[model samples]
Target chain A: MFVTPGYAQETAPAEGELQTEIVHEEGGEAGFPPFDTSTYPSQLLWLAITFGLFYLFLQKVVLPRIGNILEVRRDRIAHDLDQAARNKEEADAAVAAYEQELADARTKAHAIAQAAQDAAKADAEAERKSVEADLEQKLVEAERRIAIVREAAMKDVGTIAEDTAGAIVEALIDRKPDDAAIAAAVSQVR
Target chain B: MAEDPIHQFQISRLIPIEIGGLDFSFTNSSLFMVATVVTTGAFLYLTTSSRGLVPSRTQSVSEMSYEFVANMLRDATGPQGMRFFPLVFSLFMFILVANMFGMVPYFFTVTSHLIVTFALAMVVMLTLVGYGLKTHGARFFKLFVPHGVPGVLVPLVASIEVISFLSRPISLSVRLFANMLAGHITLKVFAGFVTTLSGLGAFGVIGAVLPLLLTIAITGLEFLVSFLQAYVFAVLTCMYLNDAVHPDH
Candidate 1:
């Protein structure tokens, strides 16, 4: 049932050897091992040596390495965080600049649209004024031509009436009337 | 026999060295102590050799132990208390590892011995008094005197304070030693029961199962006590060091 080799060894000759040694040293007292003062010197000596070595090793080697690792990690994290914050600030500035440009472009576009509309309205007004002046001059010229033609037609009608009257008088008198008579009669009729 | 729980703690000389007529022979206790130092050193050394930005599993253990003791000392004695970090860390690791090594079957428990524990406790007390006196000089006595006490009761309180202060090392040492000693004894007794009962008939075999279960349970409990005692010792050391640093309270 004893699994460990140490236990088996202890159960064998070593156990008897330990008992005899204890009996010989302590004069058959067989006292508790821990309370045995005879072992104190050796225990204290070894404890000091081992503990001192351990302390020196820890102080010199282990601690500084652990401390350095922790400090480096902390510094790295801080640096990364600072970098992230800087990048965010830059991005924010870029967004603000982008929005400012967008607003400026919108305002400029509105001004350009307004200028185009004003120019178009001015062009339309000038074209209408010129067209109205041309139409008025054409109407005046047509009225003058109509008046001259009506005067000419009235003179022609008067000549035709004189000729017709001379012919009629000649037929009644069975002789041709004189040209001077015709002219005098036509003048009396006017 | 395995029936004798005290048998496990017997220190047999592996090398019988006699120097100046004193028995300075290297014993099993010494062997385990050296083992503890080597194992602890190697663990810390190898695990941290990588020094990965993202710590590996073993590296995390080393780092956690460092931070655990570091934070405990810091919390107990504040930042200036960190000067004794090496001492506190050493005591903590040594006791912790020694106690754990004791849990292994047939392994000598270094902390189970009274002399060893007392010696460790003395280290703390010596540091406390030495550092306190060096830094604060005569003012270190203020640790024993209460701030607000009746004039008539001053002497009484101071005497009690001094007595308690003197008893610190004894209690500290005894606490660790007694716990380790008692726990190992109980575990051995239960295990011995299983062996003795199994030698009987089938009924005895059935009876042995209970103690076997109990042995397993107590073994687990001992492991806890092992870690806890180490922690308590270190923390108390920190508190005592705090008194050395600031003795008014």
Candidate 2:
């Protein structure tokens, strides 16, 4: 609902003292509080006073505390988020380091395996050379023994051949050949 | 006869004082106004005395009230409106408390009076004018002229604009005053019917039931209107202020 213009028109002329007399109708009758002409000034004065005091209190005490609380809460949340991000980065770095160290260990193991293989190959090569040298020495010794035995056998064969020649002559001409004669004969044949 | 429903609104001079032939008497209205201020102060002070990250129930309520007004101001007037947060908040608290106080048995509602609400509306309007003039200088009158209005209709539109702009105080004051007045008057009327009917015999007792139920319903509705009116007053104040702050279109 709206304020009646008639009330405004009526109160427009009754400015100063008449307003008060009308408001304090000793009996306080005939008008609604909305249309009452007299109580305007004091009510406005008190309202001004009351609201002014309230404003001061709100500005000074209440609003600042609320603003401060909200600010503190916001800062706390932001700081927590920052700390969380830093921790996450640190964790990621630590994982990367672990991965790097693991890769290095794998590489080192490969290098150890490669070095062991090379060392085994060298050992096998040296053993092969020594074994070959020892075998060659034994073969040389065996060949010398064979040569000595063959010479002995060859002497025996020469004696047997003379005997065989004597026996054959005895059978064919009823005579035996002597060792010296045989030797002379063998030399002539040579 | 039942008590006059309008009798409750009559202003009584408690400590009659006259200064310079003016009636500046201490009154029933004054008593309730002081009570509203005191109650509002006590609530804020007590609820917020000890700050906690996890708030108490009272603290939550206090904070909600703060956020409610703060958000309204921000939504209507932008961050620039924060400067008047104290005024807006105080107006809301005072009106809300006073209206709620009127709901209590036999308590006077300061907001129900036209003089009180008009005083508040004038403060808001005057602040708008004062700050508009101060901040925008003479350009503040540009509010009376709409952008894109035809030059031929400019004077007519401007005059209409000026009238409506001036009526801000009346509409603002009367809106709250009327809601409270009408709601309370309806409530009183229904309640009076119960008293009047109960006097008549058995038939009267039977007739009182309907008015009693209506009275109960209106009382509950008045409680809701009390909070709503306070909200409207504060929101309208913010809008008027926003106009002052940015009086372009």
Candidate 3:
């Protein structure tokens, strides 16, 4: 394949001093055998050998190694990205869940606070009614006792006044006291 | 045809100059090579100077060529082969330019010569050896011996591998130069035949017509061969460069 056209038998001058010759020795000689000049070298032959060897390298060594590196790197990168996305989603979900729990807890706390406030208000109202009832009963009893005392005192005063009136009448007339008047006064006193 | 065919290969000298026992004559071939270099340099520089995010048409083509070889190298020799991208790309450009240059009316095809193609092949061969050694050191020799081969067959296998290795430069250079030279010479010979026959009278015209048609067909075929030759050269270089990068299985 490396032959130059300048030295071809046809183009070489008949008397040209240039050492241009194509030597084809049929008998396999001692030195390197000259290439076959009668027939053109089959391009397919060299092409096949070249392609075969090339394919071998590709299939066996160069491509496999490169492909492996790329495949592994791709898988690793993809896995890392997937893991990151998953972690982000999980974090987001956790935050959402925590926020939801906090809101629920806050709502429960608010309800509890409202419920406690209502209970306290009801308890206070009941205590106020019961204490008012107690105070009213004491006031009525005191008033009844005071009325009784006052009526007794008033009766005594009436008796004393009648007795005195009788004494005064007897003295002024210079006569002894009468039993009917004394009995009437005593019955009045009783 | 000249009595000496070698004399026909020489393009007329532009300026006759002798320097220090050397025939430092400027020939048409030298002019084209210079033109090629200048043209290529100017083209790449102009196209790539303002390499924008959105490329110009020329810039796009240049980048495509770069990427084409870059991808080929990477595919053939793995990522390790990317370092040789410049060499391979330059080679592809130079050889393609040289090959196409030959198709012009008054230009010489440097690649159609043995010395040029041999030098290119030698570079590739030397590079292959140098890189293999650099990469693998003394262990590079172990490429000849497959691991699973029986010990008894070691000698046979080693010999075959060495012959194959040594033949790389020879095959690489011959394939390119031979195809171009053969096609061109055949066209020239047919053209000569046509013109020679037409120099005769009326019946000669009919005889000349056939050779003219054949020459036309051959010219078209040569054009196709030029592209094919360039492709083959580039592809083979890729394979050899592959060997350099990775010698083992």
Best by DockQ: 1
Regions of candidate 2 where Cα sits further than 4 Å from its true position: A1-31, A136-144, A147-155, A164-174, A178-190, B1-3, B192-216
Error of 2 at B203 (Å): 7.2
Consecutive 10-residue window with the lowest summed lDDT within model 1 chain B: B1-10
lDDT of 2 by residue, B70-140 (tens): 99999999998789898899899889999998898677778878888888899899889999999999899
The single-chain TM-score for chain B of candidate 1 is 0.99
Tens digit of per-residue lDDT, candidate 1, span A39-85: 87888888989999999999999999998998899899999999999
The lDDT per prediction is: 0.89, 0.83, 0.66
What's the distance in Å from true for residue A119, model 1?
A: 2.3
Q: Kindly list the per-residue Cα lDDT of model 3 for residues B1-249, writing each as its tens digit.
A: 222223223333444545555544544444555555556555655665564445678866666666676677788899988776656766676677767777764356656655456667777788888989988997788878767889999999999989998998889999997887777678767877787789898899889999999989988888888878877888889998887787775
Better of 2 and 3 by TM-score: 2
Error of 3 at A180 (Å): 72
CAPRI band for model 1: acceptable
Evaluated at residue B168, the lDDT of candidate 3 is 85
Q: Write the per-residue lDDT of candidate 2 for residues A9-77, one digit (tens) a residue.
A: 234543663356445545455455556767766677677777788889988999899777767877988
